[model samples]
Target chain A: EAGVVQSPRYKIIEKKQPVAFWCNPISGHNTLYWYLQNLGQGPELLIRYENEEAVDDSQLPKDRFSAERLKGVDSTLKIQPAELGDSAVYLCASSFSGGDGYTFGSGTRLTVV
Target chain B: GESVGLHLPTLSVQEGDNSIINCAYSNSASDYFIWYKQESGKGPQFIIDIRSNMDKRQGQRVTVLLNKTVKHLSLQIAATQPGDSAVYFCAERKGGSYIPTFGRGTSLIVHP
Candidate 1:
């Protein structure tokens, strides 16, 4: 089966610009996640969705970051007026459920200057 | 024996030797544990996983050990190869939550 798919594998934007990333989870998977991975560090959860409802978004920066999963199939993560600190890999993952193992996409590498 | 950032340890082993990587999980309530291998410019790929009820599990040329008492997890790669050189991370999932917490990852270098 095909794994989770993400769009725009790499992106470059100037500071204060608006950027968006898209993700499509695997078929039959009910859980989707967005994570930020800094250089030489593990992924940090930004938001998690169980269907269309976001179950965990405590780690997300609501000031500039927002994520939405519509119809429980596709997800979008956007950063308006992105800052230089937002440069990193944005990973999207999917799972059958909370207990199931996750499958991640190649991720979108964002470089904010 | 040393850390790069946030205890991101690095391990080096010969190709013909066995290699072991260790991880320390934080949540005692976590019931599922997984190990992931990630190459440069790529996302994490599943390696192996073990439940809280089990202490050890093995796969082809790979092994995972879970110690619930101390919340320690480990991955063993037998007959390490140059292809095994990458960053490995451990993740834990709680019984009722869908979010999994990930470790800082370890850099494994297999010398040929």
Candidate 2:
């Protein structure tokens, strides 16, 4: 079985440009998550979805960042007018439930100059 | 105020030796814990997890120990190999919560 899949393994954009990332989680998994990782830091949770419902997104920067999981199997994270600070790795993970069985994608590395 | 942090930023050990990574968490309500290993240019991979009800759990060559009293978690790798070199992070979550707080990660360097 394929693990979580993400598109555009690497992306480079100038500051103030809009950027988006796509994720396809493992089949049969009911929970999906989007995380951001900066250099020398662990991945931080940006948002979480449980079967199309975003259960947790307190850490997400609503002003510039938005995410959606329409079918509950795939998700997209968007950052409008991304800034230089937005440069990092965006990872997507899926699990059978809320607590365990998590599988992660290779992630999209975003660089904003 | 929920946070998880590692004791060291890096750990260097001989290829055949064992390694222990430590973490401290502030959320006493956290009942579930997990350890993840991440390599360069890749996302984190789940290593092992333990619930508050249990004190210890083991998998393959790795073991996770939870100490609620001290709010501490540790990962022990036996006979560490070069392949084990990666950044390891600890995450904790409470009952029914979908979000887990992650630590900064400890870089393990296995020397040959």
Candidate 3:
């Protein structure tokens, strides 16, 4: 089976500009997650979705970051007026359910200057 | 706040030798733990997992040991090869939650 897919393997944007990353989770997977990873650091959960509903987003910076999972299949994470600190890899992962291990995508490398 | 951390930032081993990576987690309530290998420019790939009830779980070439009493976790690789070189991360999931908390990874370098 094909693994989780993410678009635009790399992206460079100016600070204060808007940026978006897309993700397509595995087929039949019901849980999707967006994580931010800095150099030499572990991935930090930004948002988690169970189908179309986002169940966990407490860590997301609501003022600048927003995410959506439409139709419970694909997801997009948007950062408006991106900051220089936003430069990091945006990873997407999916699991069959809350009990299964996650399958991660290659991730989108975002660089904000 | 709950957190997971590794004892070493990097580990170096000669080929054909055994490699061990250690992690310490603060959450005693965590019931599930996973080990992941991440090569440069790639996302993390699952290596193995062990439940809180189990003291050890073995995979093809990897072994995951869980010490619930000390809140410790370790991953051991037998006959390590250069292909095994990568950053390894340990993640813990709370007993009732699906969300996992990840620790800073340990970079493993296998010398051939």
Interface CA RMSD of each prediction in angstroms: 1.4, 1.4, 1.0
Best by lDDT: 3
lDDT of each: 0.88, 0.92, 0.94
Residue range A39-99, candidate 2, lDDT tens digits: 8788888998899999889999999999999988899999999999999999999998844
Residue pairs with colliding backbones in model 1 are: none
Model 1 lDDT tens row, B1-112: 2211224489989998998998886667788888899998789999998989999999999999988787778899999999999999888877876566787889999999
Return the top candidate by DockQ. Answer: 3
Q: Which ten contiguous residues of candidate 2 chain A have the minimum total lDDT?
A: A95-104
Using Cα atoms with residue i matched to residue i, what is each candidate's TM-score against the true structure?
A: 0.91, 0.94, 0.97
Stretches off by above 4 angstroms in model 2 are none
Q: In order, what are the TM-scores of chain A for the candidates?
A: 0.97, 0.97, 0.97
* Model 1: residue B56 alpha-carbon error in angstroms: 1.1
Predicted complexes: DockQ each: 0.68, 0.74, 0.83
- The sequence of per-residue lDDT tens digits that candidate 1 reaches over residues A1-113 is 76889989999999999999999999988999999999778899899899999988999999999999989999999999899999999999999874375789999999999
Order of quality (lDDT): 3, 2, 1
Per-prediction RMSD in angstroms?
Answer: 3.1, 1.5, 1.1
What global local distance difference test value does model 3 have?
0.94
